[model samples]
Target: MTATEFIKKVFFFEVLQGLALTFKHMVSPAVTRQYPTEKREPVPGSRGLHALVRDTETGKEKCVGCGLCAAMCPSQCIHIYTSEGEDHKKVVDRYEIEVLRCVFCALCVEACPFGAVALSEVFEYSGYTREEFYYTKEMLLENWDKNMAGEKGRIYFEKFWRPKTVDFGAPALVKTEERKTV
Candidate 1:
């Protein structure tokens, strides 16, 4: 209606301003990473993949099959079956985690009194089928074995944000027995 408004409309002043902003960003530094080639390190307390911790002494699973992790999982993705071992201690018969249903809440990590389970930094595990996502106890243990080959004791757990009193026990001074063979 006004002369100024008419000039702006005819000249497309707002469109020019938007174009200028676009041009500015085009020449600026890229914020996105070149994924696959350059992977970014996961930030502290980032919940990625679940792994079972192995005991230092016997090179066995640290989980006593207390079923705390299964009970705490809000998504109900965790399943555990325990049976009495020859030593009279409760042993984990089966542990399965449906990765597709997991919420990555890290509650399972917090609920384990023995710190047998932890979320790792390996977030790239993807598959075409649902069967690939269903991680059994052996698969989870294999993940831990592969991911934590050279690291000294629970790396992700140490970086995880939690209370000082929440003890996952001391780190193993010696490397796992399996690692020594390789």
Candidate 2:
């Protein structure tokens, strides 16, 4: 081999090539998320807020009150109770989630064999009361209505489809019922 080739092997062109790539990327737009204020919604199938999705068509809980989710909870945040349904099927009487303790690890949702449990896209859910945070079956269902308003809104397209701009741009104002009324 040539002495120049031997010198390059000893000096390492690979390190220089890697540094070039790093410098090239240093000027590019960043994808890092600024949490809480500038949030990114999870794509479908991402594990987030664990919930037992009801059969909207039947207006019933998808869960059969099966104990699999409870059994699988790493943090022991889940509790289940069963009752007889109108169709004589096992029904979810209570599906209590202790939010303070839940790690949001999503094991309970994965453990559910019925495809009943789903992790919602919800990323903001802070509450003042312990009672407010300790979600019941009713609360999670209600959360779908409360949080999904933006996802289903007509203005979603206008907001979402816009090209990303400067990082320091002013934050969008929150929409309220009072604002709409006026």
Score each candidate by Cα lDDT.
0.79, 0.65
Q: lDDT tens string, model 2, 96-178? A: 88877888777775566655655566766777788877889888766545543333321322233222321325656637653
Clashing pairs in 2: none
1-182: candidate 1 lDDT, tens digit per residue: 99999999999999999999999999999999899999887654467788888776878888889898899999999999988878798988999999999999998989887778878778887789999999999888887787753353354555443324446577445465533332
Q: What are the clashing pairs of model 1?
A: none
In candidate 1, stretches whose alpha carbon ends up further than 4 angstroms from where it belongs are 149-153, 161-182
Q: Looking at candidate 1, what is the lDDT of residue 156?
A: 54
